[model samples]
Target chain A: DVKVTQSSRYLVKRTGEKVFLECVQDMDHENMFWYRQDPGLGLRLIYFSYDVKMKEKGDIPEGYSVSREKKERFSLILESASTNQTSMYLCASSSVPSYNSPLHFGNGTRLTVT
Target chain B: QKEVEQDPGPLSVPEGAIVSLNCTYSNSAFQYFMWYRQYSRKGPELLMYTYSSGNKEDGRFTAQVDKSSKYISLFIRDSQPSDSATYLCASFTSGTYKYIFGTGTRLKVLA
Candidate 1:
């Protein structure tokens, strides 16, 4: 079984503070993604990494960035956290882009920016 | 228009009842369709997947896709309390890594 682990389950930060959400996958998958889930908005991709040091912005990448220094780890960074950035963040990984290979996701981190 | 559209339903059903969930897409290029189930405070997990236009069944779950109308459906038979969760429909174009997701429908199966 594949294991995707997010570093934190709950987080609280003050406004204007920088926040970091970390994720690690044990399967050495080549693709990693970060998404935020909100009521009525569903899950929106924030950023994705295809390979080490290679990152691509998804639909809603503003106020956030990503790091992929190693194949097994991907991190999402909020330059300046705001109340609007509070959300349930999820991390997912997939071996490759194929019909049979769906993404395996982590439990998620619910961040509260106050 | 949104690429994928789904009613964010808080549909309530009694145990052993049949539940149906649906999604519609505006993109004709999407050939891969998927349904994910998300428990409260947890990440979404893949529940069903269908390729092109067809029906695929796994145990009590069935997934159907209609390419002509760009619609997808997921049916659950003999639903249980454990089946209470948010259901999200997703789609992707063949050969692409990105997927578009619909707003989830929250289902509550009462015992």
Candidate 2:
């Protein structure tokens, strides 16, 4: 089975702290994505990487950034965390870029910014 | 207006009930529709995806799409308690890695 492993399951950080959420996929997928899930807003894309050193801003990328230094790993970074950024962060990898391709996802890391 | 819209339903149903989940999209450029299921405290997983305007079935689940009305539907026959989860609908166009998603519908199947 394809597994997307997130480095953290839960995190607690104070406002203005820089946060790093790491993800690693076992499969050799070319597409990796970061999304934040909030109640009533669904999952909003933060950023995505198509290959190493290549990243694109998504719909809600204002406060977040991503780094893909290797084929299997993608990392989401919060330059300066805020309370509004508290949410469940998910990492997903897809063999193809299309919605038709299945996106294998990590369990998620719930962030609590106080 | 939101590109995709769905009712945020905490729809409760008895086991063995047939469940219907729906979403609407306003983007005419969306070429594919997809459904993702998410359990509590877990990440969403892709359940169904359809590229054309028709019904596609897998096991007890059927995914239907109508481009004319820009409506998408996922039907579950004989729903089980294990099927309880939040269902999210998404749409995508060609040459892009992003998807327009609707707010999810939460379902609870009671035994």
User: How does each model score on TM-score?
Assistant: 0.97, 0.94
Candidate 2 lDDT by residue in tens digits, A19-103:
9999999989999999998887788898999889999998899988888989999999999999999999999988776644656
Minimum summed lDDT over a 10-residue window in model 2 chain B is located at: B91-100
Q: Which stretches of candidate 2 lie over 4 Å from their true place?
A: A98-100
Instruction: Residues B1-111, candidate 1: write the lDDT tens digits.
Output: 999999998999999999999999999999899999999999888888888999999999999999999999999999999999999999988667788999999999999
Worst 10 residues of 2 chain A by lDDT: A95-104
Cα lDDT, model 2, residue B106? 93
Expressed as tens digits, the lDDT of each residue in A1-114 for candidate 1 is 889999999999999998999999999899999999998888899999989999999989999999999999999999999999999999999877877767889999999999
Candidate 2 per-residue C-alpha lDDT over B1-111 given as tens digits, one digit per residue, 9 for 90 to 100: 899999998999999999999999998988888899999999888889889699999999999999999999999999999999999988888677877789999999999
Candidate 2: the clashing residue pairs are none
What candidate 1 gets wrong by more than 4 Å, as runs, is none
* lDDT: worst 10-residue window of model 1 chain A: A95-104
Give the DockQ of candidate 1.
0.78
